[model samples]
Target: MTLATVESGFNGEPAVFTAELKPHRSLGPIGFRVLMGLSVAVTLINVVFFLATNALPVAMFFGLDLALLYGAFWLNYRAARAREIVRLSRNQLDIHKVTPAGFVRKSQYNPFWARFDVARHAEFGITDMAVVERARRTTLGKFLGPEERDSFAKAFTAALADIKRRV
Candidate 1:
């Protein structure tokens, strides 16, 4: 996932930490189009060969394979739209998650009571991260890769500490 850290605030106060997280899309539209074009070319060539050999069923299977591949790419593109936004101000910590289907879930906590929780692994680095406040636990950055998670956790932890110190 893409993790972008930003510093912003309202009025004349000091800037607060904000992070916008999004799922990584390795292939852009151009790349996808190129890949699909190549696939179609290859499938057409196979279809021609199968038809010449009188293997009609085999040609149909090739069409099915192409359809399935296109469907897989479509699903991936849809999922890449999901995102998370985190804002840490002096008084509050907020997490906003938006799914691919446009559903939104938000969690807010008092900065004084919220805790930044992280689970790490020796080989994989940071495996999980969450915000814990009393009985509530809100997970963050599930779509982020290990390195992204590490960077986010460090920045978020520092922001939390700074806010707490100001209290």
Candidate 2:
């Protein structure tokens, strides 16, 4: 059940750490479509009943509600496209974040100089993980659940430690 993969780097170098992090979405495209269809069907049926009772205003409100629901799901699906990729080689550590709007942000650090830190709460378990180098700190695994974050932190920490021992 490993979520991260390590591969050989360019020029025959080996990868030290690599992870692809994405937000969990409970509904897939088909499930979302089905849910939306069912909701719209029910809303339309209720609106038809209201119209028969001369509640035209209520029917209009139902339409508005459906529109809003559609917009919300659209935005959610868009955001689900966001992802974070982290890769560490013997020389460098790179973090790339891609947002829903297709904006990309990249950060690089020296593997020997960087430190992996995990912030945790007693009851809630792990909260966040970050890579710190000199004056800069970039958080990782913001989209991961507590348990996932904990697992990532352990594996990442071990990788960093191995690098440190070799250097």
Each prediction's whole-model lDDT (CA): 0.85, 0.82
How far is each candidate from the true structure, as Cα RMSD in Å?
4.3, 4.6
Q: Write the per-residue lDDT of candidate 2 for residues 1-167, one digit (tens) a residue.
A: 01122222222556788888898889998998899999999998999999999999999999999999999989888888887878777887878777877666778888888988888899999987899988999998888888889888988888888888897
Shift of residue 107 alpha carbon in model 1, Å: 0.7
Please provide, for model 1 over 1-167, each residue's C-alpha lDDT reduced to its tens digit, 9 standing for 90 to 100: 11222222222334388888998888999999999999999999999999999999999999999999999999999999888888777777777777887666777788889999999989999999999999999999999998899999999999999899987
TM-score of each: 0.89, 0.89
Please give the range of 10 consecutive residues that has the lowest summed lDDT in model 1: 1-10
Model 2 TM-score (2 dp): 0.89
Judged by whole-model lDDT over C-alpha atoms, candidate 2 comes out at 0.82
Judged by whole-model lDDT over C-alpha atoms, candidate 1 comes out at 0.85
Q: Model 1 compared with the native: what TM-score?
A: 0.89
